[model samples]
Target: MTRHHPRPRPLAALLALGLVVAATALVWARAGAGPDRCVERAERAEQRSELVTGTGPEVLVIGDSYSVGAGVQPDQSWPVRLPGRVRVDGFSGSGFSAGASGCGDLSYATRAPRSLRTTTRLVVVEGGLNDTDQPVADLEGGARRLLRLLDGRRVLVVGPPATPDRTWGEVARVDATLQRLAGEYGASYLSMLDADLTYQDDDLHPDPAGHREFGDIVAAQVEAMLTSS
Candidate 1:
């Protein structure tokens, strides 16, 4: 008597397995491709040290890469360009809920404690673009949490500008969310959604010229708020 051969696996089953493997591999690659968390944390810690040791800046600007000067020089960044002593606590690839590999969880709220200082006359919260993909509830929750932390302080919530990489709808939603939160928290809101801005090759971050323009716009807003107050 001959032994029965093992039954062949179905082609559809094999194809499904391959797709799953491919998708999993992609996720892993993306996860590993993010900036080193340790380095990011160290840099953030350095920023805190500077703020703590040196003369506290008049304006404390907290944001993502735009505040960090992603593709430009330190002085070229808009935060430094703002008309007064400004200290930036910008983390690239970070947002209210967008925490990269090594950055702290729920980035903005987690670091607000160390970033704000007694000398900071104005707290300019400048971001939301990174959280474009976040659910409205999550985005609102994150903004509320950060705003609560800044309660009783002078705050200017600067929402994200429109970018080529992001849909107008997506950017507008973020802008709207931040604006609502700012109003509820007694903070002034500045929306950059309509600004005609330029960006780097990536179409995400602003170029040198764009930084200058952004700085000018923010400076004007800051001045107006401070003057009125």
Candidate 2:
């Protein structure tokens, strides 16, 4: 008869079992094995920010502090990376208006006419952080109004970027709401709500690199709009 095999070591067996469990969990998570995994993966994608893609028209950019290069140098702003002739009329602490309270009743739409020169081929509505304090209804209405004013122009509504302090839900709401409004008004929407995007130490404004990233993203979108139109 063959000699009896040495009994498996209890500690070794437990350790092996633990490793198998951990490996299985990792694989399951990556494969989106269940509802929790699916949600987790979706969340990861939603929160990521990296390079973005196009060339196009003489574009006009209107936004808030993010538009104005809050913490970063002026050259790092998103508007600086546009294709063709660009006009940047970004307000540091202003947003669209649904009433007298929003941006002193002079919103991007109201201020846009004055900022235009030659022929504005595209209107990039950049930031809405100033509208965060405003009621949601007002924000939506203001966006609607501003988009309406850009009527025939190729308008790109770039949703407000997400900050570390703001929960995912808050940022998602702002982004989804604005995107919906953009769709309603026949404008294209580009979300800047990725959590992985760079930000300043304050965690509010984009760092120089972040702005550059945003610029690249908008440039790509601009190219698409121009080519398609």
Per lDDT, the best of the predicted structures is 1
Error of 1 at 147 (Å): 0.7
The number of clashing residue pairs in model 1 is: 1
RMSD of each: 7.4, 19.5
- Range of the 10 consecutive residues with the lowest summed lDDT in candidate 2: 45-54
Q: State the weakest 10-residue window (summed lDDT) of model 1.
A: 48-57
Report the CA-based lDDT of candidate 1 relative to the real structure.
0.77
lDDT of 1 by residue, 1-229 (tens): 9999999889999999999778756643543333355475457536533542123337888887888777787677787657557777877766777433223464688778987877778888888887887678877877888999999888998999999999999999889888888998899999998788889999999999999889888989987776666
lDDT of 2 by residue, 29-146 (tens): 5332544644543343222211121234567777766776766656667777878666666644556654322223446777777766567777788876656656788788878878
Local distance difference test values of all predictions, in order: 0.77, 0.69
- What is the C-alpha local distance difference test score of candidate 2? 0.69
